[model samples]
Each structure stands twice: as structure tokens, then as C-alpha cells.
Target: MRRKSLSTGDLARYCQVTPATIVNWIRAGKLDVYTTPGGQYRMELPKFIAFLEDNEFPIPEELQADRTRKILIVDDEEEILDLLVEVVEGSDANYIVRSEKNGYDALIAIGDFKPDIVSIDLNMPKMDGAELVRRLRSNPETKNAKILIVTGMIPTSDLVRKVKRIGVDSFMQKPIDIDEYAKALDKLATFKV
Candidate 1:
């Protein structure tokens, strides 16, 4: 378990200084601390962390936050799927990526992966992207996941309106322009960052 507070000894050990020095620093008001009933000095976690950071001290490993993002790609075309996987994985950002050939497999993957972003192709064999988007919007688990609709067909005004009403974040007409797709992913993932 992570410690909620640090003692003089703890700070001294972390700084490679004597316990007396910690007490001196506390007495001089250089470090924020509180006194216990038994006259023990205790530094709360936040203050200690701030002191370390403000002084350019290395933060402990356990205190560092994970910045990884998750992505799920749903498309029936094998070529498109492979290309997307390659592009997303090859990016500089931290992402855990998965690809599914159809919406059914995508749905199953989403249950476990709970991706932050879902890049979906509109037409597939078993279940289309439109139906998958509806399901995602309805589900509590994935309701907030960002959806980027990628389609080969020129959408009618009604189809565009329907998808927008269904809560897609953005759309890209495809022959899959690599640059535009990468830009879309960057924009979608930026919200979380």
C-alpha cells in the first residue's frame, strides 16, 4: 500500500540526509508538516510530492501516472484493417490497439478492451458500423468512447444527419487517405490527453 504520510525518517531516507536535518528543515518552515499527539512530525503525501517536484527530485516509480490510450478498429476489409493497424501502432503516441474484421468481433473486443477511440468502417458483412455505433452509444460501458466513421460510399444528407444524430465524433470518406486518417486519430486522442 502507498503511504499517505511520511515521517522525518522517511523523508531523510529518501533524500539521503540525516533525520536531524529533516527535523531542522521542518523547524525552519522549509517543508510542510503536521505534529502528532506524541510530538511526531508527519508530512502528508501531497506536500511531500510537491516538495520533491518543486526541488527537481525524481518522483518515485509508483507515483508516476500511466498515459497509455486504447484504440479499437472495426473493418471488414483485410487490407484496410492491416493498414490502420500499422499506421496507428507506428505513431509516436502510446496506444494499445486491436482490430476486428466485423462488428460482432468488434463488439466482443470492446467489452474487454473498452477502447478510448473506435475507428469504424461503415460497411461490413455481419454487422455494419452504423449498428455498432448505435450499440456503443446505448451501452453504459462505451457510451463516451469517441467514434470516427470511415466509409467508402458518398453519404447522402440523410445518412450524414443520421450518423451525426447517433453521436459520431467525426467522419472521413475513404479510399483511406493515410494523412487524413492519422490526423483524425490525433484529433480524437487529443481530447483525452
Candidate 2:
């Protein structure tokens, strides 16, 4: 059966949260929402299910899918990369996670695997996160790639403004929280193809 998308109000009622909280989640890159040509927001069913599962919130049995979700992580630090993979693997058996040590390698992998979502580190030995995002955005094939920039650098207000201009899909702090990682992935999965 084909599931229907839900509006913010509908989702709030279903999740037992306020509409304002839903809006905040959307802004925080926790909830995935689609914008119509007229700029109205709606949530996709599969992504909503993923969000619920990631948060340990209850989900209707019928809403669960059999297939695994694919994810890619790009980072220079081996420890962090491994840790991210471990967390995702432990969270759900249905997640296929892969990692790359640098942005250049990650780009190459993306072309072949075509992951549902990607998490990238802002600093690396080769290409940095900002430049990687620019390149991805410029390319027709990867223009719609869902990218989350994870960084440890403490940025000034000016730097934050500049980072926002890069057009990254989301941003997270370093030493990633497991729940937050899952939430970001769930949100990215909600994006319309």
C-alpha cells in the first residue's frame, strides 16, 4: 500500500508533539520535510518511520520496510569514521554504512554507490568539506546530494555566515551524538528524490 505524506500539524498529532516543536525539529535538521513549489511543507511517510525508529519512538508495524538504508560517511579521522560506522551498524541491522577517509575518495564512492545520504567532515587532508559541497552542488549528478557537515572547529559569527552560504544540507558538531546522527540520516532520507 502506498502511504500518504503528512503535514506538520498531522505529524505533530501523530508524534504527540506540538506543531512548534515539529517546526523546530525541521529547522534543526532532525525532521525531514519537503517544500512544494508554493513553499508548503509536508513529510514523507518512509522518512517519518525512519525518524521514529531512530528516536526509539513507537512506529506502526505496517509502516516498517524490509530493505536496508544506504549511508556514506566521509572523514579524515579513522577513529571517528569507525565510530560512526559502528553506531549506525549497532542501531539497525537494515543500515548499510560505508566510509571514506577523504572528500576526494568520498566523491568517487558516491558516483558508484549513490548513497541515500552522506555525512562529511569539514576538515580533511585533501579536499575540505566546503569545497566538496561546492563541487557536489555544481555537478548535475550530485546536485541534489544530501550532505551533512560535521565539524569540531569553533567558528566566529562571520565564519558561520560563510559556512551557511556553502549550501550544505545540515551541520553537526564533532564527537557526534549517536541519536543526533540517526536523526540527521532520517531527515535526509525524507528528502524528495
Candidate 3:
């Protein structure tokens, strides 16, 4: 059956939850939704069905035991991107890390690479991290994709709150710690949804 876009009320009824709970899910990034030009939300039917079947949200799986997983790293700084590439290249964990200078290019790479995880920098030209997160969350294809915010900007508290609010799966601070980065990827690799 083809499913049309649903409103919050429709979602609440189908999910057997209160409207407030649905709103919380949206805020928590547990739900995938997009706002119209008039500011109304449209929910994807297939993902919603998957949520019902699994009783949990879906997220990308890890790279195979034998093959490297594809990862997209978005940042404007050449030096930082280069450093990240170097670190990933040195890791025991197999990963195909692709770097993009800005969010615009990152969006394009997202479609082309179909990465298992995305590490995004908060500050960038064209589109900032917040907007990029919003865009990723809005699109059904990328909505459940694992996202990690790696940024040097923003205070710690603010950064934590913002990332949580947007439903980012994980986060890391700049001056990239190789161990921590590895840990984050490890966690994402194992994450079921």
C-alpha cells in the first residue's frame, strides 16, 4: 500500500502514543519528519512502518568484518580534514573515509557514497552543522543515518544541548583525539538503530 504524508495527529494514532510523545520523538531524533514551506511536518510512511515492526528506530549497520565501511567527513578546514584522513588511514578498523570541504558537497557525497556514518563539523561555509543536521533529518533516505558532530566551535554545554536537540548519534571535539574518534566509530559500528 502506498502511504501518504502524515501529520503529527496521524503519527500519534498510528504509533499508539500521545501527540506530545511523538513531538518528543521528533525532538530526540527518534522520528523522521520534514516541515513544509508553510511549516507543516510530513512523516515518511516506510520508516514509520519499520519503527512499528522493530519497536525501535533504524540506523546504518557497520562495515563488514572483511570490508571497510564507508564514512563521510564534512569540514571546511583543509588541515583538519587532512589530519582526520590521516588518523582514519592509520586505524585498524577498516573505513573508506571521504572528506568534503562544506555541507553542500557533503550532501552530494551522501547520495553518491551512501556512507554508514557521517562526521560533521559545526562550522562550515554554505551550510552550518545545524542546518546540515536538519536537512539530513528531513530526508527519509538519510534520516536514520548515524551522525557525529566533530566541532571546535560552540561551548561545551551549548554543544551538548544542541547536538542532543537535533538527535545526533554522537559527538567529538576538535584537535581530534584518535582514540576517542576510534571509540565513537566503534560505538556507531555496533549501534543497531
lDDT of 2 by residue, 21-55 (tens): 99999999999899978887899887886687557
Q: For this target, which candidate reaches the highest lDDT against the unseen true structure? A: 1
Give each prediction's root-mean-square deviation over alpha carbons: 11.4, 11.9, 11.8
32-55: candidate 1 lDDT, tens digit per residue: 999999999999876886677556
Model 1: lDDT to the true structure? 0.84
Off by over 4 Å in 2: 1-68, 157-160
lDDT of each: 0.84, 0.77, 0.77
With candidate 1 superimposed using the best TM-score fit, by how many Å does residue 56's alpha carbon deviate from the native?
A: 32
TM-score of each: 0.65, 0.61, 0.63
6, model 2: CA deviation in Å?
24
Q: Worst ten-residue run, lDDT, model 2?
A: 59-68
Q: How high is the lDDT of residue 119 in model 2?
A: 85
